[model samples]
Structure formats: C-alpha cells, structure tokens
Target: MADVIKSLNLLETLKESIENNKLSDVKDAVEDLLISRINLAVVGDRGDEKATFINCLLGLGPGDDGSAPSPSPAAPEEVACYLNPKHPDFRLWDLPPVPSTSPFQPEGYMEKVKFPRYNAVFVTFTQTPHPHSVEVFLEARSLQQQTVYFILFTSAKDTEKNLEEKRKASLVALTSHGVSLPKVYLVRPSTLEKLDFPGLLEEMARDLPEIRAHALLLALPTLTPTLITQKKESFKALVWAAASLSGGVSAIPVPFVASMVDSSVGVRILTKAQSSLCLDNESVERLARQRGADPARLKELRTCVLSVEVTKGEVKKRLAAAEKEIATVSSKLVEMAMPRHARSVSRSFAAMLQALNGAIDEMAADAEKIMAAALGKGK
Candidate 1:
C-alpha cells in the first residue's frame, strides 16, 4: 500500500515539474541507474512451468513454461511450476493455489506460491480453450489493478472464439465485482524485442519507470525532430508554388511565367515566367506547336481566356482589342496578390497557364495612362 502511495507522490512531483517547465533536477536524479526491473507472472493451464508450450515471447525469461507437458506425465497440473524463471531481473513468479490442490490436504501448492510484485501476467491457454481457465484470467485481471494481463495461446487452432468469450465475461465481472481494471491484451508471442509487443509493455509500465525507459529508448527514433522539419519544408514549397501559378492565371500574355513556375526548389517552386498563347488561327497555331495542346480542345481552352477570337477584323484592330483585355486582367491579378487565401492553390498549372493567353486588345491602357496628362489639360 505504501508503495502505491510513494508512486503517487512521485507522479505529483513529475506533474508539477512539467507544468513549471523545470526538469533539470529530474534528469540529474537518476541518470546512471537506468535499468527497469520488469516483473512478470504466469498462470492457468498453459502457464504451468512443467509444460514447455506456447508461441509469443517477452523480456528476459526461460524457454519453457517449466512443467511442460511431459511425454508420459501424471495428472500434470499439480506438479507444475506456475512460473518458469521464478527469479530473474524480470521475474516471472508463480501464481499460488492451483485449484485442485488444497493447502490442508498436505499444503496447498498454490498457498506456497509467492505472488511477486509483478509488472504483468502472461495468461496461457490452448487451441480450444477451457472456459474455466478464461474465468481465472478474468478474475486475476480485476485483482491486478495497474498490472497488464496478456493472453498467450500457442495451439495452432481457432483460439479467437475463447478470447472473445473471455472479454465479454470480464466486462460483466468488472461491473459485478466493482473492480476497476486494465484490459487484457491479446498477444501472439514471437521475439522479445518484436515491434508489435510494445503496446503490451507500455500498458504494464505505469508505476515501473524502468519499463517505460526501454520503451522511450525505442520510441525516440520514430519521433525525431528532423521529421518535423521535413514536413514543414514540404508545406512551405506547396504554399509558395500555389502563390505563383495563381498569379499567372491572373497575368498578361507571357509564356515565360510557365518556365518560372517549373523551377524546382527544395519542395516545388512555382514558375514565374508566364506563357500565354491563343489557339485562334495564327496565335492558335503558334501555341499548338509550343504546348502540345490537342487541336480539338484548343477552342474549349481558349474560352477560359478574357478576349474572344476575331476572324474578320484587321490585324491591328484585333491586337488592339486583345491588349486592352490583357491589361485589365493584369490589374486584377495584382489585386489577387493580397487576397485572404491563396487563389491558384486549388487549380492545376495548365489551367492557370491557359488563362495567360487571352488575345491582346490594342486599346492601350498604357497609352491612356501616359496620355492622361494631355487629356486632363484639355478638359
């Protein structure tokens, strides 16, 4: 009971340190003594030390379950060791009181079994699980409090059915017994350091800082600072490119912008060299050769531009009208520069590139800006 109290006190101290952002003392306290003594307990039919059977594996423990099913064994359950490596850095202790043997009928074999302060318990079973064993594990989980209960079934048979039944029964027992307990983790034992077993270990690491120490040791690489930096660089490039193409869609006739957007920076730098070529006859022919746009889709693509193609007008008149529309959209593009959200981010580069080819209306806004002084004086 005092151990739990001490653990709570340490936790409160840790919480205070975090809130105050003062952790220098924490680092200095236990820098050298960094070993975690993980405690483990084995129980039920499969956990019997005599019978060396089962698949999933964990931390430092021996190969067999101890009294592994002998070639010619006698009512083997009583003669079994509850835990194989009863004493080790990570102790797998015996669970006392094997049901059939009473301490009064000589000595309850289980009564002598020491219930070690364990980190977790490995509840073993076979292929077609006996419901009795599942019941014992469920009861053990309720009593263990913070300790994690992991189920290990080695028989290469349909074991899922028994596990589901245990789960439903455990849920009911918790309500009836009023025992707030941790969930039983179902594990397929393999190698000790197997990546898949971390979740089980983490569950049992509550009061034991040592268990958590090893976990954090493996976890650091996955949460490196370099990964965070890489993601930021990617997002930055995307935002920058979106800014440029959106600019082109709103600009004057300039194919150079397309090349500008094509430049590759660390991420993807958008192009600034704008190219706008119309597919209406002469300009259309020029663009078709340059951009490889399908001849059929040229007109459809042209409709996205600001000016309509004129077939009958004089060359100068058509150019004059096209230039006027170009300047108007150019001004709008500048206005879009200060927009609340990025404009071109959602659009494809080709779409923005198409917008650049609007025919030049010869009505010169540049000339008007220049001749405004003369007109002002006359008015």
Candidate 2:
C-alpha cells in the first residue's frame, strides 16, 4: 500500500513535469534513475573464497575480465575494487583480511577500507566465524552501517547437520560478543540458489537504500526466477519515468519540426533493460561459461528480437507498431494520468510505454529460458 502510493506519487511528479514542459528536469531524473551507485564491500580472509563470492555476485566467471583474482596466499594487502562490467556505477570492493590479533581491533581496518562509504557489508568465512569478522560487524553497527551480513561459506558436500552446527556455533560466538540478535547465512557461492543465498539477497534488497537496492537487483545476474521477477517489477518505475521523459522532451516546442524524441529514449531504455536482464551478449556468455554450458547454445534460448538487438531503427518501428496495437487500451490509462495541456505527448507516451513494457516482458521471459537452459533444465 505505501509502496504503491509512493510509486503513484512518482508517476504524478513525472506527469506534472511533462505537462509543464520541464524536459530538462525529467531528463535529470531519468539519468539519475539509470545511474545510481551501489558500493558493496566483501570482507573475508580467503582470497579464493572472496574471488568466488565476488564473481558470483557480479555474474562473472572466474576468468572473466572484471572478475576478482584468486590471488596466491600473498594476496594484495590493499583494498581491491572490482567494477561491475554491466553497470559501471556499481562496485564490489574486496577488503584485505582483518588482522588476526588476539584482541581484534576494527577501527584502523575500517578506516583503511573506508568502511563508512559502502552501502552494505558482507563478512564471509569458510568455517567458524572469525573473531575478527564478528568484531568488524559490531564496529560497523556502532558506525550506523545497519546493512551487514555474516556469511558462512560451506562445502556443498557438508551434511545439513554439519551446516546447522556451524551456524549455531557462529551465532553463539556473535551473541557472546553482545550482539542482541545474531543471524548467519550459510551459502555455497558456486550455487547461489542453495541454502541461505537467496534469503541474503532478499534481505539486502529490503535493507539497503531504495535506489541502491534497485540498482543491486538490476545489476545482478538473473539467477533465480524470484530474482528475475523482482528485476522485472523493479523496471516499472523506470519505464514510467522513461516514457514520461520521452513525452516531456517531445512536448518542447521546436520551430516547424515534428519531434521524434521517443525513438532515442526507447532505444536507451531497452538497451539498459537488455543489459540489466542479462540478455546482452557478454552477460549471456559469462553465465554460460560459469555454468559450463556453451554460450552459443544459451544464446539460442533468447527468442526475443529486442533481447538480441536494440537499435534506433528497431525502436522506432516497434514504438509505432506498439502504439497501434495497444493504443486503445493504453491511451485511456495514460490519458487519465496526463493533463489536458499535455495531450500532445499522450500518444507518444503511450506508445513508448507499450513498446518498452512489451520488450521488457519479452527480455525477462528470454532470460528465464536462458537461465533454465544454462542450469541443465530443458528450454
């Protein structure tokens, strides 16, 4: 209910801007929407484990260009920043191992890593939760870093009882340190769908700032159907803003020329959607490689035309076609939200909304198929 109202308020704000011909403001809003930044810090001792966890988070295979390096025992002593290939604004910073001192001190380590800057923190360990790891979480809590995770990376071959025991031990250790309520996530980075990985992601989505959470959802690889659905729904507000921006830009008075602004907007929207949904060539190939599946075979699973390519010419044609196909139904709803003074852009807005919505649905469906095929499920 509150979320729905908030969404409606945003839509109304955009509509008001379009009605008043505030195209520049609308453009800024859309730019901010598409480029929000999320800084995630993965704090753990094991270089190999950190690399694997970071790779899985960023949808990269071990050998991919932007994947974290599983450095030898002599890992780099400084913080290493791993850029998300799909979204430059999003970053994963792998901090050096917390010093294994008898009396763990987190202040110097936190300052060195600029801990306050990260939107969220993940403290990971292979077995027992390190004393340093718990101290780090406690320090982060004191510093108002509310979004933190204590993760135990367990072997897939480990029995359920063994996993439960490890979690209990970790919780006990955390509680002993005055943590009122302690929660630990047991995961296998190789298979994020197993154990507590999905729940951890859900908590991240709920706990982080709204825009950063949205960025995380869209930037992550389409691993689970639940995530796929969340990613698809996250685009709703973006689609509305994009279409409104298109309408607003076109509404601006230009001497003796018809504005074809929606084409460019549509192209940008779908291109971002393509990458966010993991329909782009690079993302598909990386996921395929990570799952030991042939990239070409996975690519064949993407049946949507826009999922394959989003171009200006293609966008223009689709916009016109979608407008014609859904105008009767969409126009009524769009018209209700648009003011009388902004009627000129109503058709354009409706067309862009229709085209982008259809493309997003098609791309999301294609991503599901690709993921299924990559996971050895028949397409």
Candidate 3:
C-alpha cells in the first residue's frame, strides 16, 4: 500500500516533467512501469533552477543591478525548494532535507529535494496578487493536482481599507477558477515578538503560513494517521500543517516538560570544553518520544528491514560509534539549549535533524532496493 501510494507521487513528478519537456513519457516509461514499488530515484530537471525560476516568477530575481552575473542564480529549471545543506541565503532555514549531492545537480535531485506536497502553495508578498501572478500560481497548482487546487498567501500590506481592497482583488482572482477555492492566510510575525516595530513585519508574519508550514513540517509526525492516510504520501496543505502544529512540544504542558531535557543541558559546557557525546538511552528515548517516534512502528520497521547492506560487523561498528557520537551531540545540544535567542529554536532545529536522520534511514532502505535493482547487484 505504501509503495503504490509513493509511486503515484512519482507519476505526479513524471507528469510535470513530461509537460515541461524535461522527459519524454514514452522514452522514460520505466518510471511508470512499476506498479508495486515507489520510484525513490529523484528523476527531474534542476529544481535549484526552478527555485531561481520561482524567484524570477515572483519578480525577485536576483534583484539584479545586472551586477556580478546576478550572483550566479540559485538554480535553473525545475521545482526547486532547497536541496543544499550549505545553503545560507535566509536567516532561518526550516525546510527539511534528505542526503543529496550537486544540490545544484539534476541527477537524483528530485527525490533528494524535499517539498511540501502542499495542495495550495500560498506565496505571500507585500504586493497584491496580480493577474499574471495568479495565472502563474494557477499553472503551478495545475501541474501537480488532478484538477488544479491551491492557495493565495498575502499580507495586509496597506491600511485596513487598502488591505481589504487588495484582499478582494486576490480573493476574486484566486476563486475566479470556478473549479477551485484557494486556501489563504495573512502573515503576522509579531506573534513571535512582544516589541513594537513597523507593522510590516507583523503583517508579513500574519500571512506567513508558508514559513509556518516549514516549522509545522518539523512537527508533522504529530499529525494523526487519518490526515496522513488521506493525503497518503503528499504534504498536507499549509492549512492542515498549521492545524497540526498545535500538537507540538510547544503545545504541551509547561512547554517541553520544562525541565526534562534541560536538567542535563548544562553538560554541554563541560563537553564543549573537552569534546564529548554524553546523552544516554533515557535521554534518547525522551528525545525519540519528543521527536514523536512510534516505538511500535520502529519495531515493525526492524522486521521490514527495507535496506541495510552493511555487514553485521559494519553495522555493529556504526552502531557503537553512533552511540558514542550521540553522547557528544547530546552535550552540545545542552550547551545550545541555554542560549537565550537560539534556545528553543536551536533545540527544535536539532530535533528536526534527528527526525530527518530517521526518515533518511527509511528512505535509504527503500532507495537501495531500486538502486540495487538498477545496478544489477544484490546483497
């Protein structure tokens, strides 16, 4: 059931590539041939370019003074989100990832480049959703959906009256497609800040469901199985992602048990002074639970063994070393757990990395099956 659903996602990716002329459906029929397995291989054009294309699409293209070859553009021609671990463009990078190379490279890039299977991708800007912008968004939504559905993200950029005027224009353009009703959100960043600034930042945050979607994704395991089952393998709409965030640790009593992970957080100072990995099973279990890992599912996964080719000897070695490494990482986590500004953010960020590691292990096993099949090799 999982493989079939995953393959359907591949079909969606293939369809977009075909329409864009990156691949010939008839020529690359292997992608479509499988009925029981998901195509883990990321087969698509350059998403970084697509990211840049998106930038250009949104009229934020390099802000080129035509200077310095326009900073070499982030990427070229596909559905780029963010594939690089080294990417430093934004202040906070909350997007998730898988192991990838040539993050700038097209080969095996699609699967590696994580994206929100957001049914409605609301792109909020200080500007109104113009007609051409609406058309671009419509096509973006159409390329992936069976019958075109999506969202419009905006900020109450002007005064209340002007905001209403822009909202009406955007809403009208968005719903203009009689076939769909777009999801919309107004950003308000001030929700995180108690201080006063020009209201622009608050206005932006008010409608920033897109940004929130990234944070929400980190906490996605909390989304009930029913919502997940309905969407199958796709990302929940930003609205749904937003809805699920209410289940995060922040939503819990005393916010993260208040002292459970923190009591040992100070060990980081000692560990950093000497370099160490001090977290233990209790800590990991607390964290794993905090990360929302299902003990039952992990047990089930042990039996499934989707992919693990290393010898028992190697597995033991990695397990031993990783055990040791966890102690060092744990101590460091404690250190950062205290920094005023980066405290929760860093902790959540670290927790996110841990979650990604688990997801990668699952995906790796799935990927190696196809990888071995393609390479004509076997364990």
Candidate 4:
C-alpha cells in the first residue's frame, strides 16, 4: 500500500510538471516510469517459422534476414535474443526445441533454458503437436508460468475449417497426455494481419498489465486502427506524469529558469511520445516506401503538425514569450507589493499549465493524423 501511494504521488508530480511547462521535472518523472525490460520467450520445434514470425513482429523485411537466426533441425538448441531497436525494453527470446534424441528429460531442458524467467512463453508448432513441445508446456504450467500454445500454419491459404480441425487435434493431443488445453493462437507467418495476432498481443497485455505499455506498444504492429489507439492511450498516461512535474517546478521561486527547464522537459516528452507511437522519421519513411508513396509527402505532412522538433520549437517560442511577460509583471509586483508578486506567480503557473495542455492536445491530434496518412487514409 505504501508503494502504491508512492507511485501515485510520482505520477501526480509528473502530471503537474507537464501542466506547468517544467521540462526537466517532466523528464525525471517519465524516466521513473520507463520499464527496464519485458521478457518473452518463443519455444517451438519449427525453428525456421519461429524465426520468421519473430522477425515479422520486429518489423524486419526480407533484406534483414540475418537479424534473427533460423535454427535448423541439425543445429544445437541455442537461445537467441532479439530486442526492438525503437524500444529496447521489449526483449524476445527464441528458445530452441528439446532434441528428440537427447537423453535429458523435459525438466532438464526447462532448467537449461531458465524457463521461469520469462514473463510469457509461446509454444509454437506447425501442423501437428509435438510431444516434446507438450512436455515443455506442461512443465511450464506446473511451474505456474504464463504459457500460450501457438499453431503456425504452413500454408497461408488454409481454410478456416482446416484451421479449426488442426486446433481440435492439437487440443486432443494435449488432453491425451492428461494436460489441460492452454490458450491457443493460430497464425500464418505470411499473413499475420489476418489471424489472432492482435488477440495474442491483447492476451499478453491482460496477463502482464504492469509492463503492458512497453510489451504491447512495442511489439504490436501499427497497421491497424486498434493498435494506433492503444499506442495513444499508453502515451496519454505519461502526459499526466509530465503535467504534474511541470506544475511542481513552477512553484520554484526562480523566475526565468523554471520556464527554461519546462521547455526542455516538454521537448523530451514529445520526442518520447513520437518514438512510442512509431511516428519517428525511420518508421514513417519505411511505411511510405512500403506503400509506394513519396517519402517526401510524409515530411511535408509532419512539417504542418506531426513533427516533434517542430512541436518543441513552438513550445519553446511560446514559453519564452510567456516568461518575458511574467518577468515584467513580477518585477512590478515585487517593487510595489510582495503579496501581489506571489499571486502573480501563482497565475503564471496556471497559465503555463493551460498552454502545455493545448500543446499536448495538438501533438496528439497530429500523431493520429500522421498515422492515418501512413495508412493511406489521408491524401
């Protein structure tokens, strides 16, 4: 309960900082909430398909083949770690299958890989269920670990009936071994957008709400409207933190210095939000190129509103102007009446909060517009 109160106080401080335009305080607040790492493990027999699916989630293209290792049947069970370049906190582990010819038991295999360390484990298979994979899943359940049984179809063109039949057979296989059927997801590596990809992500988020902001926001593709909305909502929570920090900084007796600090913090928050939403230059350029659209158009659209640098510049300009006005009023009040000076300072804090709120609203709206344009919805 004490920890919860501390967290709430920190969030309140962050929100106040953002509202008061105290940039440095907002940065401190945001840094406090940034997740260090979220561990996800992919356990499967089909190494090639598993690697391909992992790469797809990382948004790597064919040219980036070596980004994830595709282990073959003949190869040893080596664990490969894949981190999202944009959000390094999300770590995906590709765990090799337990060899059929190996003398070691399933429990030994689990211990070798440090299975309990993972927040979520995915047991992937193609066509039929493998006994070794089922053994690993049961062991994971016995350890009280969160696990998902994933079916990756070899053919993207498989009909719904065929997919359902495969799912039933997989369940039967698990039941035959006296193991309960785990949450299952059917996916086609070639057509990830069509299947239970989003559902799988939502399930992970539901199970691990503490790291949901980093887990789902970083791993899930931004091709769908639902994903974009989730990204926005995740960032919105940070906005309050930023605002609280800004407001706290405004209480300082120093005049111009507080405003300067606020400008810098605001820039960092906006930049972080841009990256989190996958609206950075690299992501946008990749999207434009993929859709056969001119990358220059994205730049043009960004200049109008979505660009973080542009937003930062505007925020600094406005804050600077406000600071000058506040300084003049403060000087007059200090000479004539100290009470008036204190009141003026309070008003300035309120004004800064209002301005910051407008800036945040504009940036969020621009982010949405940028996403729509990337999806080919906006001309």
Candidate 5:
C-alpha cells in the first residue's frame, strides 16, 4: 500500500512541477526516478555458483563480456563490481566471503566491504546457511538495513523433497541464532524460470525504496510474464512524465508567438523505453545468449514498428500520423482538467502522449513475443 501511495505521490509531485513550469524540478524527477543509481551487493563465496548466479541476474552468459569472472581456487581478496551493460545505473557488487576465523568477526568483514553503501545485500550459500553469513545479516539488521536476503543455490540433481528439507533446516538455523523472521530463497542458476528466483525479485521490488525498485524493474530482463507486465506499467509512468513535461512547456503563456512541441522529446522517450524494455539489439542478443540460441531467431519475433531503431524522422512521422486521432481524446481530457484557453497546450501534450503510449504498447507486445519464442513456446 505504501509503495502504491508513494508512486502516486511522485506522479502528483511531477504533475505539480509541470503545472508550475518548474522545468528543473521535472528534469530532476526524470533523472532521480527513471535513471537513478542502485547498488546491490551479492556476498558469499560459492565460486562458480556465485559467478553464474551473477551472470543470470544480469542476463549474461558464463563467457559474455562484462560477466563476473569465474573465481579461482583461492578466494578473492577484494570486492569486485560488475555494471549492467544494458543499465549502467544498476551495479552488482560481488563481495569476497568472510575470512576463516576461529571466532568469526563480522565487524571486520562488514567494514572491509563498506556494507552500508549497498541498497540491498544478498548473502548466498550452497548447501546450508553459513554461521558467518548469518552474522553478517544480523550486523546489517543492526544498521537498519532492511533489504538483506539469504539465497540458497541448489544443484540440478536436488529434488523437491531435498529442497524443502534444506529450507526447513535453514529457517531453523536462522531462528536459533535469534533471527526474528527467517526466509530462504532456493534457486537453481541453470533454470531461473523455476524455483524462487522470481519470488526473490518480487520481494526485492517490495523491499527496496521506490526509485531503486523502479531501477531494478527496468534493469532486469523480461524473463517471466510477471516481469513483462511490471516493466510495461513502469514504462507507462515514464511516458506520462515525459508527456507532462511537453504539455507543461507549451502551456506557459507567451507574448505573441505560439508554442510548439519538439519532435526530439518523443524520440528520447521512445528510445529510452525501447532499451529499458530489453527490446534493443544488444539486450535481445544478451537474452538469446543466456538461452543458448542464435540472436537472429529471437530478433525475428520482434515485429512491432517501434521494435526497430527509433529515429527522429520516424518519430515526427508518428506524431504527424497520431495527432488527429489523439487530439480528440486529449482535447476531452484537457477540457475536463484544463480551461478553454489551454486547448493549444492540450494538443501538444496529447500528441506526444499518444505517440509515446502507442510505441510503448507495441514494444511491450513485441517483448512478450520475443520472450515466449526465446523460451521455446509457439507463437
């Protein structure tokens, strides 16, 4: 409920800024809400499992460029950061596991990693929950960091019964050590479509701050139907904000000249939406590689007009084509919310909004098709 209210409040604030013609505040909101920075730390040392998990989360293959390096036999001595190639604003930090000590001192370990800098901390383990890792979780709790997670990576051969037993055991250990409430996410890196990986993402979306959660949603690949739906909704908010900015600019009273909308604004909004929805060539290629398929086969599934390269000329063409139909709907909306004198501004805002929304809808449909095809489903 708080998340929904917060999102509405943010949109309301942006609407007010646009109404007041606070261009700077509107721009700042765009940066802060859509393209903000989010740091996520994955702590623990399962070597190949750890690296593979990171790759899956970032939509990378084991050998893809920018994927986390497979650790050697010796544990890594320092923390390493891997930026999401698609979304540079989202960073994943792989922290070295706590050193083997007779009596584990989590304070030294936390200090070494600069823990508080991360928006979410994920402590991973393979078979059983590690005491030292739980200690880190406890320490993070003390610091009032509520976005901590306990992830258990299971092997392919692990049966459902075995997984259930492990979950029970993990909860028992966490509770025994004074954890108020315990939760363990059982994941198989090879098959993210199965298991609790999706649930983990949902939890993160709920647990992280609003802006950070929005970043996470856009940064992730549209692997499941749930994620695709969430991404579409997020893009709607973005389109509304960008369109409002255009409307706000044109609505300002002028001396003698008329205000016109810029075609570049629509171009920028559509371009950002295309990449954020993972419909671009690079994102599609990455998703294909993760599925061990050829990129061209998946690219063929993107039949939407906006799925192609978004260019300014194409945007202008769309704006011109959509204006007549959009003006009718937009005029009615503007009539209800705005005055008679605001009709001119309504046309500009309505055209931009309709064009962007149309593109987003087409791109979202293409994304769904590509995801289904990539997952080996029939069209």
Candidate 6:
C-alpha cells in the first residue's frame, strides 16, 4: 500500500511537471520511475543441466554450440554472469556446482560464490538430492536478508506423475536434514515445456518483492498463455502511471506543446509494453521462424514492430479525429459559460488519455497476435 501511494505520488508529480511545461523535470521523473533491475543465481551440482536450464530460460536454445558456455562437471569452479539480452537489467549469475568431494560447509560454499547479494536463487537437482545443496538452502533460509528460492528439478520428463514423485523425493531428502523447502519446479531443459513451469513463474511473480517481480515478468519469455496473461496484467498495473503522466501534460501553458509531450509519453509507454511482452520484431521473427511460419508471413510480422514515429503519428491522427466530438461538448459547456481555459484543459487531458489508452490497447493486441501466431493459433 505504501508503494502504491508512492507510485501515485510520483505519477502526480510527473503530471504536474508536464502541466507546467517542465520537459526536463518530466524526463528525469520518467527515468527514475522506469529504472529497475533483478539479480538471479542458479545453483546446483549438475553443472551441465544447470547450464542447459539457464540457457533455455534466456532463450539461448541450450547453447551447446553457441555463445553461452555449457558448464562441465570437470570445471566446477567456472562461474558465468551475464545480463539477459532481452532485458539488460536482469543479471543472471550461474554459480558453479559445489562438488560433493569438496568441503561441504554451507556458509563457506555460499560465501565462495558470493550468493549473499542475489535477489533470488534457484537450487537445481535431478533424480537424487545433493546433501551439500540441501545444506546450502537451509543456510540461505537463515540469512539476515531474506532471499527467494525455487527448488528446480532439471532434465526431467514433463509428466505430472514423474514431477510429483521427484518433488516428493526431494522434499523427503530435505526434510530428513531438518530443512523446510520453498517452491519446487520440474523443468525439461531441452524443450522448456513443462506442466508446472508456468505455475512456478506465476508463484515467483506473486511472491517476490515489487521491483524484482516487475523485472522477472519483463525478463520472462512468452512461452505459455498464462505467462502472456500475467504480462498483460503487469502492464495494466502501469496504465494509471502512464495516464497520470499524460494528464500532467494538460497543464502545459504553451499551445500544442502539451500534446507533443503527450505523444512522446504515449510512445514510451507502448514501447515498454511491447518489450515486456516480448513482441519486438526480433523476438517475433525468431519465434515465427521457429514455429515453421512462412517466410513471407514472418517478414510481414517483423514490420509490425512498435516505433516512436509510428506511435506519434497514430496519436496525432486519433487526436484529430476526436477533435469534432470534443468541440461539440466544448460548445455545450461554453453555452453554460464554462471558462475557456477550463474547457481547453479538459479537452487536452481527454485527448492525451484517449491517445495513451488507444496505444496500449493496440500494442497489447499485437502482442497477443504474435503469441498466437507463434503458438500456431493464428492465420
């Protein structure tokens, strides 16, 4: 609730600046509001499986022969850290597996990998549990700063029965050591298609702190309908912020300047939504190609990528079309003797909000269409 209030206040401040023709102040506020980052650590003893899972999560396609190095059991000390390409702010740290033969002090192991600073950690396992990993999870639970954990079962079949058995066995092993478990997910690293993976992602989105949850949602690939819906809801949560920013432009004293600023703000909001939904040209093209879509159709889809110029043009066109309706209402208000300034500000605010709402709706629909086409549900 505090965060909500803070966000509202920030949005209002942004609106007030726009109303005052404070372009620099508006830019600064938008920059501050938009800054977000998330740090994630993947830990497990099966180094190869862990690498495969991380690669798949990043949409790097197992990376067996690609840029992402496949971790080998022989090199248990090798660690990889990189920002997710789709979301530069999402930092993923692949911690090397703790060798069973090495010293098994959980605190020492965690410190060795510098895991204390990560926002969230995923402990991966296979058919059997590693005693050292279980101990590390227990230690992690006791840390001064709370850390989110997801117990991942990698390189597994997608059947619910198999997943449940593996999850139960892992739980039993952890319980034997007096360790309470966090959420567990069974993932097939090869295909990244699992019955529970979406649920796991939803739980993470629901459970993590706000900033981290927002970053995670932006970083995730649109692999399932549930995930796509979650992305939409996450974007929807920011509409008020966008609308507030638009309404702020209404206060600008200069004629036409407020509308220009509103156009840019609308573009920014829609672009952010497009990126968060993974509907950018590159993502959509790659997904289409992978789905065996026709070459010409893929080319057509790529052209639908969101752009600032296009968004601005659309907003201007819509505003022009709405002017007649606004004029009719304004004339009625004038006959009632409403102040001209009040009527002008009302028209400007309405136009700005309408433009933003229209842009968001169009971008969301494009994202859904892309997702459907990729999933073989679209023409």
In terms of lDDT, the poorest run of 10 residues in model 4 is: 333-342
Each model's lDDT comes to: 0.33, 0.76, 0.29, 0.59, 0.75, 0.58
Better of 2 and 4 by lDDT: 2
Count clashing pairs, candidate 5. 0
Model 2 TM-score, all chains together: 0.87
Per-residue lDDT for 1-379 in model 6, tens only? Answer: 1123333444455445544556566544444334447778887764566766776666555442232465443356766776667666677788877668766688887888887778888877777567777777777777743454545555543467767787887777777877655455667664464555666665665456654666566566666655566555545445444443444433445332344444565565566666666666666655655566753453355334352124667656765665545555445633232223344445655555455555556665666666666667333
Ranking by lDDT: 2, 5, 4, 6, 1, 3
lDDT of 1 by residue, 198-256 (tens): 45544444434532333222111111122222222222222323324334433344343
Q: What is the C-alpha RMSD of each candidate to the true structure, in Å?
A: 26.4, 3.8, 22.4, 7.7, 3.9, 6.4
Flag clash pairs in model 5.
Answer: none
Candidate 4 ranges beyond 4 A from true positions: 1-29, 32-36, 46-48, 69-75, 102-104, 147-154, 212-215, 218-220, 249-261, 289-294, 297-312, 318-379
Question: Could you tell me which 10 consecutive residues in candidate 6 have the lowest summed lDDT?
Answer: 333-342
lDDT of 1 at 328: 43
Superposed by TM-score, candidate 3 places the C-alpha of residue 344 at a distance from the truth, in angstroms, of: 40
Q: Which candidate, 2 or 5, has the higher lDDT?
A: 2
Per-residue accuracy of model 2 over 171-288 as CA lDDT, tens digit each: 8888887787899999887777779988887777667765667677777778787777777766766787676655654546533113335476667668888888889888888787
- Models ranked on TM-score: 5, 2, 6, 4, 1, 3
TM-score of each: 0.33, 0.87, 0.25, 0.72, 0.88, 0.74
Taking the tens digit of each residue's C-alpha lDDT, what string does model 3 give over 191-266?
A: 1111121122223223333223222222122112222232223222111111112112233243322322321211
Q: How close is candidate 1 to the true structure, as a TM-score?
A: 0.33
Candidate 6 colliding pairs: 15-248, 19-251, 19-252
Which residues of candidate 1, in runs, are more than 4 Å off? Answer: 1-33, 46-88, 94-97, 100-111, 127-145, 148-154, 159-182, 190-198, 206-379
How far off is residue 185 in model 5, in Å? 0.8
RMSD of candidate 5 to the truth, in angstroms, is 3.9
Q: Per-residue lDDT for 1-379 in model 5, tens only?
A: 1234445555666667666666566666566545647898888874888888887778778777788877633346678888888678788888887666668788888888999999998888887777788888898889889899998989889999999999999899999887988999998876676799888877887788766787777777676866777777676666666665566554455321122257776776677777767888988887776666779988887887678788888888888887778646745665654334445567666777777778888888898888877787321
TM-score of 4: 0.72
C-alpha lDDT of candidate 4 relative to the true structure: 0.59
Candidate 6 TM-score versus the reference: 0.74
